[model samples]
Target: MIIKRVIRSQNRVIVEGKNLVKKHIKQGPGHEGGIFTVEAPFHASIVQVLDPVTGKPCKIGVKYLEDGTKVRVSRGIGASGSIIPRPEILKMRATPRPTVAGPKDTPNESCAGEDTRS
Candidate 1:
């Protein structure tokens, strides 16, 4: 199953076509009440990462390369022990840090222990 999203704080993941649940929405202002089918979050430990080379689910282990770069590899039963490349989405930042301070941003002087309320 493909992982749709990860809830790191809760140690849960929403896997595609897994752990489906029915959500009951209450009627509220400008909202309609209905029963909706949605993907529920499950413990991350319950799922296994598939080995890219073997195309089978396998336990993952951390391996360090010669250059000291750490990577995840398949390590359990019938494992091919191939390195697993990180998904591109995981490398992307959900919200990039602002390069320039906005109007609501605190001035650098105050942040650096300088009193701005003189």
Candidate 2:
């Protein structure tokens, strides 16, 4: 594996790999000598170099099969899943709503913004 790009921020580092995207440039109809290229970047966090046997995080472990292919396994360490509250979960759903409403449409508009209690 080749290390392409790396960015360090505080206690974390972000890395980009070349395998993320394949660049292709093709000449258009009656096009000049301008080269066209497509570039795509993948998140480094999506990939990990782990052991072949276990599907966990690992510092170093690799094995090649008889078919000349390499296998990897996680190094036995990974981030834990997150836990969210029920109210917070509902906030992510979609709900229908009116397009627009005028001041006269709702008689309580003015009162709603004001504090009724002295």
> Model 2 misses residue 96 by how many Å?
53
Evaluate all candidate structures by whole-model CA lDDT and list the values in order.
0.91, 0.46
TM-score of each: 0.63, 0.23
What is the alpha-carbon lDDT for the whole of candidate 1?
A: 0.91
Question: What C-alpha lDDT does candidate 2 achieve relative to the native structure?
Answer: 0.46
lDDT of 1 by residue, 1-118 (tens): 6888999899999999999899999999998999999999989899888899889999989999999999999999899999999989878998998999899998877779666586
What is candidate 2's lDDT per residue for 23-114, written digit by digit as tens? Answer: 45566788654444433445556555533354344453455668986543233355222221133433564565656785557665566778
lDDT score, residue 88, model 1? Answer: 93
